[model samples]
Structures are given as C-alpha cells and as structure tokens.
Target: MKIACVLLLLLNLQQVRTDLQYDSCGYWTYSKGFGLPEFTERIVLNDVTVYYHDSSLRSKMPCPDWINTTAGKEEWSSIHAWSVHSRYVSALGFQSATKQFNLTGSLSDQNIYQASGCCSLYPDGTYRAFVTHAFNGKDFLSLDFKRKTFVAAVPQAVLYKTLRERDSATIEEIVAYYRTRCLDRLNILKQAPGVLIRKVPEVRIIEQQKVGSITVTCHVTGFYPPVVQMVWLGPDLQPVDEGVTDVLPNEDGTYQTRKSVIVPEEDVGEHTYSCVVLHSSVPDNITRVWGGGKAGGMAVWISLVCIWLLAAGIGLVVWWYRTRDAVI
Candidate 1:
C-alpha cells in the first residue's frame, strides 16, 4: 500500500508538470496589442527545460498538443488570457473581464459556467485583476499574486504612480541593456542653434620680391572667426622665427590675413617657402607656397637684359666704322 501511494504521488506530480508545459513563444505576440514591437520570449518549462520564441511571426497561438495534459492545457489557457489582459492594460491603460456561460444539459438552463478575470502580474509577483459583471461593464478587482489576495480597482492615478516609479527604476537599467547590444543604434545629431565654428582658412604666398632683402608676403583668406597664427614654414616643414601678423576679419564674416618674412640673401636665391595657417579645431597644418623660387630667376633676367643692350651698342659702332672706311 505504501509503495502504491508513492507511485500515485509521483504520477500526480508528473501530470501537473505535463499540464504546465507552456510555450512562451505564444505569449511573445501579446506585445503587439500593447503597441510594442515583436520580440522573442525566453521560456523555462518544469523549471529546467528552456526554449525561445521565433521573432518572425506576428500572431502566434500555443498549440494544444504542446501541453502534455488537460491540466496543462487549462493552465496555459489561463496564462494566455492573463497575458492578453496585461497587454491591454498596459496599452489602453485599462482592462475588463466577463463571466462566460454555455447551456448544454437538458434539465439545466446553464450547464457550463466559468469565472474569468484579466490581470497584470508584475515582476515583483504582485498582480492587478479586473473582474467584470454579468453585463460585462467596467467592474474590476486587483490582486497581489504574491499574497494571493484581492483589492479594489487600480485607479488611473495609482497606475500612473506605479508606472512612474517603475520607469524611473528601469531607465538606467534600460540604458545599460542597450549598451551591451551592438545591434542597437546610437543617433548623434548636430543640434547646435548658431554656428560655432565655420569655414577652414586657406593660405597662399602671393609674391616674393627682392628689395635689398627678400620680402615674402603671404595671403590668407576663407575662414570664419579668423585664425590665430599664420607663420612661414621652413624647408624642413618647421616654423621659423619670422615676423607674423594678427588675423583680420573681412566684412563678409570671413577673414583676410597677411604675414611677411624677411629671408637672408643667401637662402633667398633659390628656396621654397610655405605659409602655414593654424586653427584651433583642425589638427593638420594648412599651407600655401610663394614662388617656385630657385636659382634667382629675377637677377638672371636683369643681367641678361644689360648684356643684350651693351652688345647692340657695340654692333652699331662697328657698322658705322666699316661704312666710313668703304666711303674713303
């Protein structure tokens, strides 16, 4: 007899477990009614077996065969109904329930009668149940599932208060959750009202003329708010201690700047000079060139001109002497 009782108890537990087999895959779709995008649900069965819902389907209903027994079927039905109710409550801010009855017996007018209620079960194990009247009106009942008791209506004020409190607690948690998800997106928008920093400037060496000493003048333009420093870059691409001028802003909200560097006569003959513009925001240097100045082309041109004039004068004198001799 003792062995038989133990066997029966084991069978009962197994039956209960079979009845509670639920595919949370079906419950995942309830979020659509709540205005949330579809997502997969992680479901654990018998406190050990686990499965996940496929995210493709919009509306999914748990199959009756998925539950192992009639009790499991009943439990799943109740759970699904509760889930739908919770979704409605969360989305619409309210929910309603009604008792359904069906007549089957010949002697009795109402043979099948079932009490139905919709409720949201919180993560804390508390629940808010909405029970309806025979006419299916706005009657409700709130229950704490943890304590297994009932309460009055869940007023809008109370619901909003609970939502605010829960949202505050969840805000940081949600941010942390998204931080781990590489699939999520971060939107960086430029929303500054007025212009902070504008166009980048251009630098150019306009002229390099020899006036006793080589004077290199560089022209810079095309920057809003102007640049701070414009200097001469040496052949080695380093800043020289040449004199630089302050940037002057133009009338059209741009800038025009000039700087002159005095070059040594020896280094002046044939060397490349760069005008480098420095700005606060940009890292790399902006530069422009003076002349391709090499081998003193200007001095060479002056010497060639003087030689040509002297040769022409000598040729003329030689022609005059030859003609006079011929006449004599």
Candidate 2:
C-alpha cells in the first residue's frame, strides 16, 4: 500500500509539471546582403527585423557611414550582388527576407556565389555559429564554425569535392575562423546606435463575476522582445492548472498576454490568489495578488462601505419625504 501511494504521488507530480506551461527563448542573429541595382543590408534578432538598408532608398535618405563609402558600394555591388543572385537561383524559399537584383550587370554568368552567416545564443550560455556559401542558387558549402566541421546542406558538387580533398588543410585552419569574422560582426551590428532594449512587462490582476464562480485574469502588457511567462498561483503558491492565452503582439511593438483561473465562490473572499510574472528584463519575479490583500482588499472594502453609506442616505431621504406627506 505504501509503495502504491508513493507511485501515485509521483504520477501526480508528473502531471502537475506537464500541466503548467513554460517558455524558453534564445537570441538569434543573422547578417544578409543583397547586390547590384538593389543593394540591401539587414540584421535580424529572433524573428524581428531590426536593421535594414536599401540601396534604392539611399538617394532619398542619408546613408550610414559604414556601408556608404565608395569601396563599400563597390563591394556590395559586386559581392553582395552575387549572394542575392545565388539565393534567387537556389530558390530555397526561406522565410527570411528575400532580395531580388536586376539582371542587367555582370550577373549574366550562370555561376554565382553567396555567403550568409547566423549565430545563436542559447539560454544555457552556449553559442553556435553557422555559415553557408551557395553556388548559382544551390548550396555549395556549409561550415559549423563552432564545431569546426563541414555540414552537408546538399551533396558536394565535383568541383567542391575536389577542392575539399586538395585544400583540407586550409579548411581545417579556418574552420573556427567565423567566431570573430561573422559572429562578432553580428553582435556589433545588433548594438549599432539605434537598438532599443526590451521593456519590462507590466502585470495587473482583475476579478470577473461568472455564473457561479469568479474568474481572475492576470493581464500583462507593454513589453518588447515578446517572450514572457505568467502563472496563476493558488494559496499554496503552486501554479494553478487553469488555461492561459497565447501572447499577442500589440501595434506598438509591445506584447500582451493573459492567464485566467476560475476561483470557487467560497474561496473568493477567504483565499488570496497571486499572479507571478517572469521576464528577461526583470531580475526578480513580479507578484500581484487579489482577494483582500493589503492593497486590493483595502480598496474593495472602501468601495463597499461608500456604496452602503450612499444607499443608507438615499433610504433616509425617502423615509423623510413619506413622513412629510403623511403630516400634510
């Protein structure tokens, strides 16, 4: 019997763990360049596109000093142009932004080359960098800069196979090279002048009267970098298994999320519930409580007393009017 009870308890704990939802987000960084008549440069973090520059828009707006120089223009016009054409032919249909270059210039050659790189910072304090070079829209080569190995995105063409066999020594030397060349550049571009830090989320709790019970909702809003966790806690400070809504993006680049629980009618006034929020910007978890806590209970009682006093005064006035009419 004791063993059965222990197994049952463990099963219950596992269920509880599965019932409460959790969130884990990481940092993503990518650098892309487009070429020719429509030169473009961009950097993205997570899924949000942060920095973008279009050669088309350069004439209308002042160009940033870093990529606006004569040598910069030439490099973008030639090399980045080759990258965009490679993407156009490879046609991988990546969800990331696509660039189309005018076919007028030196791009008449069927051969094209591209170089794109991405770095990711995981929550566990580890980082990884990946780089890919494509030929005429087909993957030609890829490297896991951190692992110092070549990844087969697609089968190596005869030329690549022959070159790899001959230059294996050189490839080995530069396998770890992108740590500075690409990863550091990605970080530097993210911190360029106009980057905005994600704001701390604001949390509030409100009670709603349902048919036979009360539903308490914790509303969180006005935060950037859009990942957050909010949970409703019962009297024991354990998370309640009630439903939580998905985080919705607001118009102003902030995000809003809500989680709710239906409290028993009897627990409304007797027990206090709490909403705990976890976000990256906040060092400590934020807690908001309802049901007769210091702040919430005081306000509720004051409002109730004011309503009672108003009702009593109205009743007294009505009584006085009736008595005056009887005397007349």
Best by TM-score: 2
Give the alpha carbon lDDT tens digit for every residue of 70-170 in model 1.
64555555445445433443332221121111212442221111123322222122223232211112333332333333333434224333443354444
lDDT of 1: 0.39
CA lDDT of each prediction against the hidden true structure: 0.39, 0.50
lDDT of 2 by residue, 278-323 (tens): 6655543566777744335754444334333433454355445444
Candidate 2 deviation (Cα RMSD) = 19.9
Q: Cα deviation in Å at residue 204, candidate 2?
A: 0.8
TM-scores for candidates 1 onward, in order? 0.29, 0.51
Backbone clashes, candidate 1: 1
Clashing pairs in 2: 35-81, 90-137
> Candidate 1: where are CA atoms >4 Å away?
1-197, 280-283, 295-328
TM-score of predicted structure 1? 0.29
